[model samples]
Target: MKNLKMKAARAGKDLSQQQLADLCGVSRQTISAIEKGDYNPTVSLCIRICKVLGKSLDELFWPEE
Candidate 1:
């Protein structure tokens, strides 16, 4: 499924995909793929994104009911 939560958090921080990617030490394509649900990020990558966005794993990666 698409990661709307991550996208929202990124937008809330006023960051572009490239900006978030740089902060997370990943490529912009990786960030884009995650947001688009075309990629499943590793646990470590998820944590980096969470830290950069000031969000918890659940807030971003958990599947909502």
Candidate 2:
């Protein structure tokens, strides 16, 4: 359940975890936890992250087939 997609997308946007977290009103550790697959974000947080990264939920957070 490692969230490589989220990590890659964040890198593609040239954003640090702290920057994304700031944008989404979350803490850096929260972003780190998500990227590390140690935490599951709420839907609202997912949408905020997607918006900042210009990604859809499917692109950033959905499980791959």
Candidate 3:
């Protein structure tokens, strides 16, 4: 699966991993893992990220094909 691209958006918004994690109710490590493609976030986490980034879930998380 293609990994989701989140770090750019976070950086564009000037949000640190900890800040994003706090907003999403997840740990900093979770944010790191997701950004690094070491972990795949659950649907709930994806929803929260999309909300925070002001993007649709389809824009943020989707299979390559």
Who wins the lDDT comparison?
1
lDDT of 1: 0.98
The list of candidate 1 runs beyond 4 A from truth reads none
Minimum summed lDDT over a 10-residue window in model 2 is located at 55-64
Regions of model 3 farther than 4 Å from truth: 1-4
| Evaluation by TM-score, superior candidate among 2 and 3 | 2
TM-score per candidate, chains pooled:
0.98, 0.97, 0.85
Residues 1-65 of candidate 2 have per-residue lDDT tens digits of 78999999999999999999999999999999999999999999999999999999999998999
Error of 1 at 7 (Å): 0.3
Global Cα lDDT for candidate 3 = 0.83
lDDT tens digits, residue span 27-58, model 1: 99999999999999999999999999999999
For each candidate, the alpha-carbon lDDT, in order, equals 0.98, 0.95, 0.83
Question: What is residue 36's positional error in candidate 3, in angstroms?
Answer: 0.5
Question: What are the clashing pairs of model 1?
Answer: none
The clash count for each model shown is 0, 0, 0
TM-score leader:
1
The TM-score obtained by model 1 is 0.98
